[model samples]
Target: MHGSRSGRHRSDPGVAAAAGDSGLKPKGPSTLQALTDLVRLVGRSNAPQLRLRLVGAVLLTLAGKALGVLAPLVLGAAVNSLASGQGTAAAVGWGFGGFAVGWALVRLLSSTAPQLADVVFAPVRSAAQRRAATETFAHALSLSLDFHQTKRSGSLSRTMERGARSVDFLLRILAFNLVPTGVELVLAAGVLGARYDWRFGAVAVVVVAVYTASTFALSNWRLEHRRTMNTADTEAAGVSVDALLNYETVKSFGAEARSAAVYDRALGDYTRAALKANSSLALLNMIQAGIMNLGLGVMAVMAGFEAAAGRMGPGDVMAAVLIMISLYAPLNILGFAYREVRQSFIDMEEMLKVTRQTPQVADAPGAVALAKDTARRGGSIAFEDVGFRHDARANGLEGVSFNAAPGTTTALVGPSGAGKSTIVKLALRLLDPQGGRVLIDGHDVRDVTQASLRTAVALVPQDVALFNDTIRANIGFARPDADEAAIWAAAEAAELTAFIRDLPEGLDTRVGERGLKLSGGERQRVGIARALLADPCILILDEATSALDSRTEAAIQKTLRKVRAGRTTLVVAHRLSTIADADQILVLKAGRIVERGAHHELVAHVGGEYAALWRKQTRGARART
Candidate 1:
């Protein structure tokens, strides 16, 4: 059943207090806020091993940068010594060989350090991604039906996947690329100033600053394009999933062409958006490369002048250029990192928006488990002047009140939009009434834990949905610990024993998505089996046997009587013949019960709603025969 909202103000007394502003759309987090949140999350992780790996990664990154900066100087010294040519053959060989070996060792370690760091940090990054996805998924499941009804499952899943991937990307690129690059830049500048000339240091700082600033500005400008692309991607994914899930409907109407056209249009939008984003990224990369090469040119010119004037050797000039080249390597990836980091922040923000949404229906503080009436064989249900109004419906349950005593059956029959389903939802506390309370076993449902209420009620919806798993798994899902005998007994009672016995795999036969592999009647029987396995005090059969043929329906009807013997059964029926023998029948119109009596008594009324419906159904059946 759909969710309902209060037709009155917040100050209104009664069950209107249970309604909340679930429709309030929340804003996504900003980049700075996302960064802060990630920092806090890492701190809160509090894993000693994670902290140790993090620390090792940082220390190793620094060591790699330092060694990289020093390697050029060592190589330059070796070049200068060999060039001097002022010693014996063996002396020169020893001097140059020692310097060459030292340089090779430093350079070898420099390249190896970052790899080791990545290896050590792998666990931490994976753990973060797992925690993010798991927690967000769990939270999404906890959200009320109102939020879920309005949400696109595929889009939500895409958001979660992108968010988790973005976290991994940010950790890898920021830690290994951006942050380490900054440290490398500072160390390179310091080495330049302290070794050859301060002019080299000054030029390095200016060029790096310009490159960083320009990359940041351009990446920010490209953010809108990326956002558009992401939106289109999500929309495309959602369309494909919806089309596939409703494959039967599409096939029924021969609408495959329409679905394909819709998907093509979505892809077209995504392609255009992606083109813009990628083109801008290409431009950013070109600009970054230009700045680095120009900086290198300036350093080379300064070094050439210094060497010409005898203030620096050929080796020193070579060392200076090599140092600048080493610095540019990390900056080379800087453009890519900036673009990805910006995109990642957007993804993270979207995930945060979903995680932050408040559930419209939440458990009350200090709520306890439902205390069933032990003396009775079945639990009783009562609605006291209950009222509800859906936003899209003009008529909903209004000042409606009814009761089904223990061990009795109450049937609700009504025209479309007459609130039969709404009544069922209210009984199960899926949606709290706006004006009154619902009691189960003489205890207010709202006052008890939702889990406990769920334990006492079982529902078999009109369209039964099952997971893509074995038949045994779907039935056992209702009660995981239910043993084999109990499951077989329930299936046998539901008239599924013959069907399963004939199947090649029996209970192990796998049902396709939403149990579409089975026929309507078969799925309905599966639903009945699952509900019977639950063995709740309150059994809700909403058109439970609507899909079966007459013979099968008759058989199930007899089985249902046995199942409902000691249970308070609530039947929402459309076929008048189905509920003709119900203990008490309520005929509803426009959300109000217009007649209440046994089926015989209601049919005896001349020109009444129940009498009219029964005559029409009976005539339709006769005509079919």
Candidate 2:
């Protein structure tokens, strides 16, 4: 059986209150607020350089649009010259030269400006994305254990990844596509109004107005479909990841079929959502195409009539057609840009929500680091009337008080759910008591910086989760800067060196995910080795040897006896025989200590809770023998 870490800690009420109010669901920021935040975030990225580039980009955009509008006029002049029977070779050459130059310049500026803007803006965009991802990741790590337990790891990862990409996409669309398109629209309308009859400008403005209205209305309608597709996609990924992470359990229970069914269901939902999203997109495209083509046809016919009536030359008709064609390009992209921008906003807002959560446990203002001198004295732990409740109903520690004097070994023994594991977590300050205080080395744990406090204590949990790396790396995690000699010494003390040496790779042997490649006993030894390497004043063995066989347990117990010589040890154990030599033993029932004494002293009480437990275990052992 694999050793498992006990989830016996109480949830923080502050975290609970926050979760109740915010509900952990993605609550997107309002559209206006999201846009404002995006702008602010972009502005924060190397402001001096970004502002310079932004100015240049804007100027280039205006110049490009100006040339774009002027190109049609030049083409019109060339056509008019040819139609007026001025067909001389020089005249035609000059006319066509001006038209070609104007058109070429328009294309050059339109394409070149955006490329230059991208070059200047790349660093700013990258910086903003990095800041957002880093802050969000750190915040997620800082949140309460309860929050992490309730959230899916895969979903959180996707949120950060997608959110960062969305920032880049949003910036590109706003700067290169949407803003420039608006400028071009205004310039085209102005040109038509100044150089032609009012009807021409009116037609251009009306077409744009209608196109904008239709795009907005349809894009808003597609928002729900896109949101649904995103949700389904995230869910599918989460389900697949969760199923794979528990690969052993799935295989053992012959749950491969069931897991596949669950995954298939998730994917099925995603497929349906994707289909709907694509279908709606197709409809939007068709509608936009119809609107654009109809506007172009109407404009062309009106220009032809104006030319026939002598109010405009044939060159004016060609210019009108070219301008309308140019406007169609931007209008074609408008729907897509709007939809993607909206989705990006939603992604960014989701990431912001994670960053907004308040960490349940934080270093208090003016919190100080643990004194090195004090920690060197072998940390003493005191639980001064500590109390906590998991919830309104669940059993939790109640007025639990104990002391583990420096260099002493104290053991907690109890039935499952008797708050034994909770005491261990509290001692390590993994969870804070709602009432009273926990002190280490005479300083309240809450009053010290967590980093410094944790440095003084180390835990060898029953389930030793190892990263998918070499055994050497896992052991070195406790004291990352420890020399190879120290790490080997610690591994030897944990009785793991001989086994590691027998392996083909020695210390370099890879421990698969969570050390699943190792036997349960081997994994526990790795945990012990890591803790020994840490060399902290206080050592917490939370059923650390529970997975080992009797022979391995005895050997590890001998190693632990030596390791505990100058450290305060707190043990939460189910094996009565293992902890018989403890200096003090606590017998808990419900949420409180019902009996406490040395093993011999407790056994002498006959009918006492500890004595009864010892007798029951002794009888069971004799029967097994």
The best candidate in terms of lDDT: 1
lDDT, candidate 1, 1-625, per-residue tens: 0002112211111110100112222244676888896775556554449878999999898899999999999999998888887779889889999999999999999999999999988888887877778878988988887788888786687678777777787888888878888889899999999988999999999998998899788877876665676566656667788999999999999999999999989888867876676677678777877988999999999999999999888889889999989998877666556666665776677776778998766688998998664654889999899899998888888888888899999999989889999998888877888998899988888888888888889999999999999999999889999999999998998999999999999999999999999999999999999999998889999999999999999999999999998899999999988888888999999989889999999999978999999999999989999
Who wins the TM-score comparison?
1
Query: How large is the C-alpha RMSD of every model relative to the true structure?
Result: 8.5, 7.2
578-625: candidate 2 lDDT, tens digit per residue: 999999999999889999989999999988999888899999999999
Candidate 2 stretches greater than 4 Å from native: 1-27, 46-48, 373-375
Each candidate's TM vs. the true structure? Answer: 0.92, 0.91
- Clash tally, candidates in order: 0, 0
Report the lDDT of model 2 for residue 253.
Answer: 99
Assess candidate 1 and give its TM-score to the true structure. 0.92
